[model samples]
Target: MNFLKSTYGAMMLVGLLAVSCNRDEDMQQGTDTEEEQAVETSSEGEDASDDALEMAYQGEHQLSVSGGRVKNTLCATVTNDKVNKIITIDFGDGCVGPYGRERKGKIFIAYSSEVGDSIANRIITFGDFFVNNKGVTGTIELRDVSINADGNLQSTKRLKDLTITFPNGQKVVYNGSRTREWLAGAGDDDPTNNKYKITGTVTGESTTGRSFTQEIVEPIIADWSCAAQGNFARVSGVVEMTKLNGYSVRKRTVYYGDGECDNVITITTFRRTYTITVDN
Candidate 1:
């Protein structure tokens, strides 16, 4: 599948998508000091898990009961139980994958029913999974998978207590539901040209003990072709992240560029607007 070519780049860009305020000028002095790092880690954790799941899904058919395997940068060994509808991707010990990222442990993909079934679900769970040494635990459920009126594949994704524990021992908990619709290239077998329209709301608590709700005010357009060209996968979208504090709220909005493939994004908070140049 074309995902084999685009998955690496897309996952690399996911690292950049995580907002990082490491730069001193990005925010006021000592304003939510830990917020930037916390958000960055959380976002990275979420996307890493996503990247792994996508990989497993694309190569699922390659696995068999006789110790079948799928060849990829991660050097993972794939196995499955057709009777039980479970697919397992195991990255034994530690393996350096694309961009020198090391992953260890296993990912479990369980199907509620046949993949072609009208009403089926994909449940993803982990077994001591660690990406870049950060422990990731949680269940990601993709339920009600079906084709929409527009001839696009659509699904409802529920994240239940998705937690990421950083190497520093700090942890972040994330929960949310997202609606994903394959806006383009669903009929085609080339995943590199695939595009998706994602709308969702995520609630999470950062390592700094700050609680935030992130809503996608504008539908996110994810284009894999852009990533195939070594660019950001997210072409356009607007996300509002509001931190709740007693009766007050602090809002920070992120704006992906206007259908551009460049690694540039604008982050706006009540304090100021910061233009960030992401590293590809």
Candidate 2:
């Protein structure tokens, strides 16, 4: 009986050792599996993060405008990446007017979001106009323009100030509510009997207290009988002009041309009036 008891105890001891060994092996395997899974998960997360960062570094964009008396449309494509970025704008054909009379200019875009959202500034430079052998160049500084989350322009804000420099080196500055109108065919109408009017005012260092009114007309003759008598036909008219805070002035002129009664000549005249106030 003593021998049987000792043998039974020994067998029980062996069984417990076997069970412990199995349990330890299982625990080690479980730990290794968990660590492997963690590494795989971390790698996947890093890949996803890299993909998101790459996407954020690149973007595509466009801009367009329509409506108003002037049918003007402008579009731009911008490609931004970490290394380099490029932007190209297309101010559609006929954007300004007829052939030779077009609105061809370069628009510069600069922005900074680091400033407060209440104020966004921009500088616009106009190179020249295509027609009239004249150019319209200016710099407009705008503030408080709206933008979207991706740094895209939403709408134009109020004009803080404006500087216009004509081709003749004439400069004008103004601070007021100014809006742009895109006339479809502003100065390209028929020259025989077409008449048009353009009125505006400028205020700044050169034209602080000045305003102007201009009228454009096609060919017209007041004395046709003179042409039939082998004489020149003459056109006479009075142009009404005004200055800022000043009375209107009527300027009269006569235009003559040598022509026959049977044949009529078409002529177009572009007139502009300036009311300037010199600084003391």
Pick by TM-score: which candidate is best?
Answer: 1
Candidate 2 Cα errors over 4 Å, as ranges: 1-101, 113-120, 129-134, 146-173, 178-245, 248-280
For model 1, the local distance difference test gives 0.68
Please report the TM-score between candidate 2 and the true structure: 0.27
Residue-by-residue lDDT tens digits, candidate 1, 1-280? 7987799888777766654433322333335435555444444455455455455554453442124455654467777677998878888897975334577888888988753343478888899988767787898888878878977789987888888887878887889898988787653445466777889998887775566788889988877777557566677888877763321367777787789887677777665676666433
Q: State residue 271's C-alpha deviation in candidate 1, in Å.
A: 1.8
TM-scores, each model vs. reference: 0.74, 0.27
lDDT: which candidate is best? 1
Model 2, residue 273: distance off in Å is: 17
Per-residue accuracy of model 2 over 1-280 as CA lDDT, tens digit each: 9999999999999999999988655544433233222222211111111111111111111221221122222222222221322212223332432111233433333333321222435443333322222233344444444544544333332223344434444444444332212112212222112111112222333332233332212222323233223322223222222222222243312122233332222222223222211110
Q: Indicate the residue-level lDDT of 12 in model 1.
A: 71
